[model samples]
Target chain A: MLEKGTTAPDFQLNATPDQKIKLSDFKGKNVILAFYPADWSPVCGDQMALYNEMLKYFSKHDAQMIGISVDSAWCHNAFQQDRKLHFPLLADFEPKGEVSKAYGVYDDEVGESKRALYVIDQEGKIAWSYLSPTAVNPGADGILNALEELEKK
Target chain B: MSTLKPEVSSSDHIEGSDAASITIVEFGDYQCPHCAHAYPIIKEIEQAFGDQIRFVFRHFPLQESHEFAFPAALAAEAAAMQGKFWEMHDALFENQYRLSDDLFEELAETIGLDVEQFQKAILEDAVKQKVEDDFESGVRSGVNGTPSFYVNETKFDGGPDELFEMLKESAE
Candidate 1:
């Protein structure tokens, strides 16, 4: 995975069937890039749902979160609507895992993205990064802590 | 593994012996179906273990996904004002499928709380802050989802049923 202080690689991925979101679009604000394996996991350990609840906290730090997975835009749309998610889940489809690969989070064995988190500062430098075990949900505390640290700079 | 942050304190809703060797802290959402499913299993665990187990519940309501979750947590906190926190907690999960603003009142009356006081308490800013505090603590403690459990201050990597198995084996 990318290390802190590195310039985050920019990419454009599909946020929906017709809408494309670029990493550069969020240049002025802090960005949280979350790469997860898949959606519609069991109800108990839902990583996305946990993040959805923390949107207010994330915004309080002037940060926007984006989720990336190998799933198509249609799949992300269904999952987002079902979970009432307010943020975007970018589809790393078409080329398949291209964005995940750029960040060194793609898993070739499973043909999906690994569970990873990256906090990018306003200047697009990686402020923090974590590669969580596939079975575990890394949660929001790390991201929040990273954002708090950014405020001190 | 993630460990419980801040630790269980006077602010938590607790049950079982104060000096119990095993402590279970659960961060749960009231409107979540998975938590409702774990409710009865938790009851059974408490019954089987008795004094050896200490249980604490903290609200981690996913307000966006579960629309009524925050309100239900508020109702429980309101009931706490009348010394009926567990009663309201159980009632909320037992009747989760029918959770609504009205159901809170009905459950309050059934749990024998003063209806007028209950209504007033739920709207209190302090009560809302209490629930929000619980949520913030949960996030800081690395709670991944509703019904996340911490056993002896360390995160338990599985569901309630798996927790039950571990408890039973420990007692053997």
Candidate 2:
């Protein structure tokens, strides 16, 4: 997985079937990239729902949280609507695990992205990264703490 | 991130003995179906374990997904003012299917609480702050979802069923 102080790899992915979101678009803001195994799974569903509630707190730190999975744009759209998620769940489709691979979090054996979190700073450097166990939901504290640390710099 | 933050104290709504061999803390949303599902399982666990285990419940309301969640938490805190936190907590989960703005008052009345006082308490900033504090504590404690449980100050990886199995094993 990517480490702190490393330049974050950029990518353009589908936030929706008709809308594409680029990593560069959020240059001046901190970006939270949460890569998980799949959509509709129990753990993933809970993790996303929890993040949806933390949007207010995330915004307070000038951060934009985005979820990434190998699911297609259409699948992300359905899941986001069902979960009522405020953040974008980008589809690393077509090329499949292309983006996940660049971040070194792609699970080749399962053909899914592992449960990983990356906090990219406003300068586009990896500020923090965590590779959580596939079944565990690694809550918001880490992200919040990292963001808090970034503010001190 | 896996340890229970601040630890359970007198400020928390608690069940069972402080001297109990095991401690279970749950960060739950009142209106979440999963939490409601865990409610009965938790009751069964409490009944099965009795004084051998202590249980604590903290609010982690996902208000956006469950509109009645924060309100229900506030109602429970309001009931806490009357020393009826457990009563309101049980009533909320038992009637989770019909949770709404009016249900809180009805539940308060059913719990034999002073309905007028309960209503007034829920509107107070203090009650709201208490619920928010619970949520902040949950976040700090690494609660990832509704019904997130901590056993003996460490985050338990599985659901209530798994917790029961672990407890049963230890008791034997």
Candidate lDDT scores, in order, read 0.93, 0.91
Model 2 Cα lDDT, one tens digit per residue, A1-153: 987899999999999999999999999999999999989975422788888888888999999999999999999999889888889999998798999999999999999999999999999999999999998889989999899999999
- Candidate 2's C-alpha runs over 4 A off are A42-45
lDDT of 1 by residue, A1-153 (tens): 888899999999999999999999999999999999998987643899889888899999999999999999999999999888889999999799988999999999999999999999999999999999998889988999999999998
DockQ of the candidate models in sequence: 0.69, 0.59
Ten-residue region with minimum lDDT total, candidate 1 chain B: B61-70
Model 1 interface RMSD, one decimal: 1.7
Instruction: Estimate, for each residue in B74-158, the C-alpha lDDT of model 2 and write its tens digit.
Output: 9999999999999999999999999889999999999999989988999999999999999989888888987899998999988
Binned by DockQ into CAPRI classes (incorrect, acceptable, medium, high), candidate 1 is medium
lDDT score for residue B160 of model 2: 83
